[model samples]
Structures are given as structure tokens and as C-alpha cells.
Target: MARPAVRRGAALGLGMLWWWAVLRLAFAPGAGVLEAAVAAGGWGLSVLPVHCVPRAQAAGAVGPERWRGAWRAVRTTTASPLRRSDAGSGPW
Candidate 1:
């Protein structure tokens, strides 16, 4: 097993590689230009984005670091009317 320091360093390196891809795809002006650049880039460079973000997404999953754990739970309760009538049809 790698030492704690080694593992952390590896994780940091990999995370940097991930964010690099996210940034690249986000700023990319057009498909042709990005594709050409990736095709001409180093083997490792080409593989980074594929491993990082999903290829299936047209607009890739890019999120702020804070979004990682900025969750807030909300509690709301509403009482339905005792007497209710539908207008035959309405938006579901």
C-alpha cells in the first residue's frame, strides 16, 4: 500500500487532471477546434477528459467545488383544501 503522503499526492494530481479537463471542455469554442486539439495532443492529455467527465453529455457536468457539499434540507408542509373540485382538465 502506498504511504499516506504518496496517496494524497496521487489524489491531488488526479484531481488536478480532472479539473483541467473540465475547464478545457467548458472553455472550448467549438467541437471541431476542441476535437482537433485533443486529437493532436499527447496520449495522456486525450485520455484525461474521457476518464474525467462523461462523453455522453452535450453540456458536461461542471460544478463549483463548493457544490460538492453545500446541501440544505428544507421542511415544508401544506394542507389540501377540504373541498376540492377539478375543472375537468388542467396541467398535470
Candidate 2:
């Protein structure tokens, strides 16, 4: 648990560093709004894989049962009210 948490923290730290770099590059003198927007978008897309590493680590650490339970909770929280009503409960 601690190990995965540490890894997740490290990944998040790295992601923040990546964001810092993107912001620096995006805001550098002579950078246009379109150019900065493109740079930020590209950086966000690239960092997505890094974000997934933490989730993967956490799921692996928790094992299937607990991960499933967590996933259920997430689904319940995110599900549309109409969908929940149609199902008569949260998604399994």
C-alpha cells in the first residue's frame, strides 16, 4: 500500500513538473495564443499515460476484489440519475 502510494505520489510529482515545463514553454516570449494552446493540449495528452501509471499501481496493489469495489463506487458516483433509476441500483 505504501509502496504504491509512494509511486503514485512520485508520478504525480513528475506530472506537475511536466506541467510546469509546458507552462514555461507555452508562455515563453513570442509564443502566440494558438501556439500556447497547442503546446498545452499536447502536453496534457502526453501526460495522460503518466497519470495512468498511478491508477494501475493502485489497482494492482489493491487486488481484484477491492479494485472492483472501488470501481463500483466510482460508477455509482458518476452514473446518471436516469441510468441509476433504469438499473434500479448502481451498476454492478
lDDT, candidates in the order shown: 0.57, 0.67
What overall lDDT, based on C-alpha atoms, would model 2 receive against the true structure?
Answer: 0.67
Best by TM-score: 2
Cα lDDT of model 1 by residue, 1-71, tens digit: 56998989986886665666555767776535544454445445546755444534647554554455454
Find the number of clashing residue pairs for candidate 1.
0
Worst 10 residues of 2 by lDDT: 75-84
Each candidate: RMSD = 15.5, 13.5
> What TM-score does structure 2 among the candidates reach?
0.32
Relative to the true structure, candidate 1 reaches a TM of: 0.31
